[model samples]
Target: MTEPAAAPARPLRRDVAAALLVLVVWLVPISEGAIQAAPAAWWPTIVRDLGSISCLFRHRPESVSYYFVQVLRSGRREWEAIDERALFPMEPFGYRSRFDRFMERFGHRSDAARLDLARWLAARDRELDPARSPVVAVRFLAGAQRIDRARPPAGRWHKPDPGAAPVRVLSSHDLRESDRKDMSEETGKSR
Candidate 1:
């Protein structure tokens, strides 16, 4: 029998092309993250879009630093820690971290963002356990770790200072109807 007509060259070419395409698709996010790490003024539009797209693929904890929500029940001096993950679950397809979303939407010091955060927390509290004490206030704490670039990357990480004061990002009291209206108006004006 004639040496089985050497496997069709066309199929081999197609397989190689498909492998390349898959590689490119996976590399897009990694490339974007690398570019973002060292931002430049001349980045092209495609690169910028890729950076946003990369959020769906990678979690940049460095960018997030540290953020937490503190919940104080009515008449309580001590605050309970509410984990960000409990509020926002990771999407199956997207790489967006809950902390990132929390910071973007409600981490700001503005009155509107605070009120919104408080309302959300109150609602969540009610949903979780109606018998629990009502949430009187919600506060956000944000802190950034100072990285030393000169140190070697591995084992050079520095934990956040235990004695360092946490930045109070947002604080809001139990919202009344009038306060809610004011917040709505403020939001409308800002938009």
Candidate 2:
């Protein structure tokens, strides 16, 4: 048992080598993730080649501590005026993993009050209901890549309900204000 434990450390000698080992063991595959996790360009190519994960050193726990508070300590909260930026922006899958781990660690020990709080949070999930949360509604509606409100064929005109916003007849995300103005001028209200 002692020999096996020592052998594992022997294979992970250098700082970079150890970092790669951790990533290989912990980094979930992108296809199995909600967000794409990729290595930053600054990460060692050799490490990336060995582990098949993002070579990003900035957020890799091997390069730094794994605690969120520690990351905040190392970054904005600690060095407030440095104007540093992340080498690789983190995404939702990593967050999911972190939250799952947190729940696993503490869910059992939580009191009735804590359990009730969790239930309340679940009831208020904005993703499942937009009307109850205007902020979530705005973010979701406004961030859509393209809204296809094109009239269904010429003869099948459908009247808009009074409650609905004016349906966009023809609008592309590529169009600028000037383009919209020009089109509005050329085609009147129909466009």
Candidate 3:
């Protein structure tokens, strides 16, 4: 009788490999959270390196509101205030992404960051209308609204009306020195 042929060995399945890869990726965020919660003394060098990579995964989400004041020259003697969103739309993907990044780094007590944001808005306004001058300012707003998770699933969630939510103004920046100088020069010319 002929010897039976040995059954061919199977290679690793594609589905299994993919599942393993997903699991490893999921572990990154969990490990990052644990490291963040742990004491600084207990952190290892490798954990620090991993934490940097895990920045893309933000476990804590906060609601942020951005408000702005836009001043436009309606006449030589009068200036009009318009809604900032009307002048500068955040609907574009690139602008929205950059704004989000700026908010991520913004602090309640950081005047420098607020000044930078004001400068950026002034520059953008100038770029949009080179023939005219406008003064633009920005304020950072944030608030925390709690949800009642203890209630039934159908009605467990509650969100305050956006207009009604009390917002803390973290920072505010007005016109820069150069802008003030320009305004003064224009006033002199008008006189």
- Per TM-score, the best of the predicted structures is 1
Candidate 3 residues lying further than 4 Å off, grouped into runs, are 1-96, 130-133, 151-162, 176-191
lDDT, residue 13, candidate 1: 83
Model 2: lDDT of residue 90? 38
Off by over 4 Å in 2: 1-96, 113-117, 126-128, 131-191
Cα misplacement distance, residue 13 of candidate 1 (Å): 42
lDDT of 2 by residue, 67-170 (tens): 11101111122211111113113334343233323333343234443334333333344344545421111000001112234622344322223224322211
Error of 1 at 102 (Å): 3.4
lDDT of 1 by residue, 1-191 (tens): 66766765565788999888655544654465576553233555454444444334443344335556778887788877765556766834244456555565446546666667678877887787889888877766666655455642464333243236455554546555546778899999999
Residue-level error in angstroms, candidate 2, position 155: 55
The alpha-carbon lDDT assigned to residue 72 of candidate 2 equals 16
C-alpha lDDT of candidate 2 relative to the true structure: 0.31
Ranking by lDDT, best first? 1, 3, 2
Give the TM-score (vs. native) of candidate 1: 0.50
Q: How does each model score on TM-score?
A: 0.50, 0.17, 0.43
Give candidate 1's whole-model lDDT: 0.60
RMSD, one per candidate, in order: 9.5, 25.0, 11.5
